[model samples]
Target: MYETKKWKSKFFIVAFGQAISLLGSHGVQFALIWWLAEKTSSPLMLGISGLVAYLPMTLFSPVAGIAADRLNRKIICIVSDLSMGILAAVYAGLLFFFDLPVWTVFIMLCARGIGNTFQQPAIQSIIPQLVPSDQLVKTNGWMQLMNAGSFFLGPVIGASLYAAFPMSVVLISDIIGAALASAALAVVKVPELEKHQLEQEPIARQLKEGFTVFQADSKLFYLVLGEALCMFFYAPLSSFYPLMTSDYFNLSAMYGSAVELAFALGMMISSLMFSSVLKIKRKIRTSFIGLFGMGISAAVCGLIPPTYWGWFFFAAACVCLGASGNIHSIPLTAYIQETVAPERMGRAFSVLTLISSVTMPVGLLAASPVAEKVGVNVWFFLSGAIMIIITSILIWYSKMKRRHP
Candidate 1:
C-alpha cells in the first residue's frame, strides 16, 4: 500500500517534472505552429498539420492504454520522454545544418504523437494511484493549473526566442527538459496496481473490453459522446487561431502569443477557483454551463472586426474559451476517476481518448476547405452557433430524462 503522508510530496515531485517537460513541449509546439502559419498561410495546410500531429495518437491510444494497464507505467513514461528528446535532437541538427523540408517536420510530428500516445495513458492512470479518492477533483484541478501555467510561459519564451534566435536554439530547451523529466521520474517510485486475471487476454479482447466498460453505464457512455461532439466543433478552432490573429487581423506573432497567453491565464484562474474555492457538487451542471460558455466565446471571436480593439476583444474571447474548457474538462475527468473501476481506468481513459481522436480529424477535414472558401472567422461563428444548439438540446434531454425517470 502507498503511504498517505508521503503522497503529496511524491505528487509534487512528479508535477514539477511534468511542468518542466510541458514547458519545453509547449514552446517547441508554438514555434512550429507559427512556422506553419507563416509558411503556408493555408487553412487546409494547417488542418493537415493538426492531423499529422494527432493521427498517431488517435491510432495507437487503445493499444497504449492496454500497455499502461499491463506494463510498468513509470518505464513507459521514461522511454517516451527519452525517445522524444532524441527525436528533437535529430530535428535540431537538421535545422542547424540545412533547410529542413516541411514534410520532415510532419514526420517528426507523427513520431512525437506516437510518444504522447503511450505516455498520456500511463501518466493519467498513475494519478488515482497517488492521490486519495476524496481529493481526486482537487488534484486534477492542480494538474490543469500546472499545465496551463507551463503553456502560459511557453509562448512568452518561444516568441522571444523565435524572434531573436534560430529554430535550432529553441529546440535545445526540449532536450534539456526531457532529460530532467526522465531523471525526476526515475527517482520517484509509483505504486503499481495488482495484476488482473485479464492479463491472459488477447489484445483484441482487451480493446473490446475497454469499450464494453462504458456500455455498462449508459450515462457515462453518452457523456463521453457529448464531449466528443464538443471536441469536433472545437478542433477547427485550434487550427484557426494563428490564422485569425495573423491573416484576419493582420497582426504579428507577438499578438498571437498574447491571445494564447490570455487563454492560458483564464485556464490558470479557473483551475485555481474550481480546485480550491468552489466545491461544485453537480459537476454535470458545471459542464453544461461550460459548454454554453465556450460556444458564446467562439461566436464572439468570430464577430470581432479587424481592428486594434477587435484584436483585444478576440483575446478576451479566448480567455473565456479557455476557462470554460477547464470548467467542462476538469469536472468530467474527476467524475470518471471517481466512478470508474481502478483496474480498468486506463482502458476507460483510452476509450475516451479514442472517440475524441476520431472526431477531431473529421472535424478538421470537414472544416478546412470550407473555412478556406468562406472566411476563417465565419466558420468560427457557425461552429459556435451549432455548438450552442447542440448543448441546448442535450440540456433539454438531460432534464427530461431526470423528470421522467
Candidate 2:
C-alpha cells in the first residue's frame, strides 16, 4: 500500500498555493474585462485583447513543455510564478504613475500568456510525482473544484474591487498571490527525468522523440484527435455565446451574468460530485456520454424561442454546458496522465493545447460571417449536431468501445 501521509501533505501544499494564485488571477482577469468595458466599450477591442493573450499559449506551449522535461520542474514552476509576479508589479506601477493605452494592456496580457504557457506544462507534469497513482484522479478532481469556485466568485469580487479602488490596487492582489505561491513551491523537490539528459541528439530529433510516443500508442493518438475535433465546435460556440444572448434572448448585463453564474454552478456541483460521490471506472465511455449531454443542451438552447422563458432556458443551457465540460475534461485529463510516460507528459500536453488552439480560432473566424448570413442559432444547432456526430463516431470505433481508463 502507498504511504498516504507523505504524498498527501505534498499534494495539499501544492494545491493550496495554486488555489490562492488562481483566485487572484481570476480577479485580475475580470477586473481587466470591466476596465475595458468602461474605457472602449467595444466588443471588438475586447476580442482583440483576448486573442493576443491566448496566442502565446498556443505558440509556445511545446517549447515550454520541452523545457519542463529538460530543466528542474520545481524551478520551472517557481520561476513561472515569479515571472508573473514581476509582470504584475510592473503593470500595476504603470497604472499608478500614468495613463496607459489599451494597446499596452493587450501587451501585458500577451506577456502573462507567455508565462502561463511555461507554467501550465510544468504544473501538470509535476502532479504525478506529488501523489500516488491511485490518488491522481482525486487530486485532479480537487483542483477542478478549486477552479470552479474561482470562476464562480472571481467576477463578482473583481467588479466590486474595480468599483471601490484603483486598478493598481486590484493588480496588487495578483502580485502578492503569485509571490506566495512561488514561496510555497520553492520548498518542494521534483524528480528529474534521465531521458531529458539523454539529449545528445539534435533539437529536431528530440522533438520527434516526443511525437513518437503518440505514434506508439494509437489509441491515445485517436483520442487526442477526437478531442481536437470536439473543441473545434466548443471554442467557437463559447466565443459566440455572449452575442447569442444579446441578440437572440435580448438579455441585459444582469441576465448575462446570471447565465454565466448558472454555468459556474453546474461546474461546481459536478466537480464536488466527482470529488466525493462519483467513481468513474469507465472513463472513455463517460466522455462520450457527457458529450452527448452537452450536444443535446446546445440544441435545446437553439430551439428555445424568444419569449418570457427564453432567459430561463438559456440559464439552464449554461448549467448543462458547465456540467458537460467538467465531466468531459476531468476523465480526459486523468486518462492522459495515466496513459503517457511521465517523461513525455509535457510534450504530449503541449501538442494537445496546440491542436485545440489552432482549431478554435479557425472556428471563430469561420463562424462570424456565416452567423451574419444564416443567423447565430444555426451555428448553435450546427455545433450540437457536430458533437453528436463525433460521439457517434467514437462509440462505433471498436478500439474505443473496448477501452477503459
Native-to-model Cα distance after best TM-score fit, residue 100 in candidate 2, in Å: 2.7
Instruction: Tell me each candidate's TM-score.
Output: 0.97, 0.87
- Candidate no. 2 TM-score: 0.87
Expressed as tens digits, the lDDT of each residue in 1-405 for candidate 1 is 457999888877887788889899888888888888998899998888888877886899999889888899889999999899999999999999999876677888889989988888788888888888788778888989998999899988888888888888988878888898888888888987888888888878988877887787755665566677877887778888899999999999999899889999999999998779888787767877887888889988889898988999999999999999999888878877777776777887887777666777888998898899997999889888888888888888867877896
Candidate 1 to truth, TM: 0.97
- lDDT values of the candidates? 0.85, 0.74
Residue-pair clashes, model 1: 0
Clashing pairs in 2: none
Off by over 4 Å in 1: none
Q: 319-372, model 2: which lDDT tens digit per residue?
A: 898888888777777777887777778777777667666666666666656666
Query: Which candidate wins on TM-score?
Result: 1
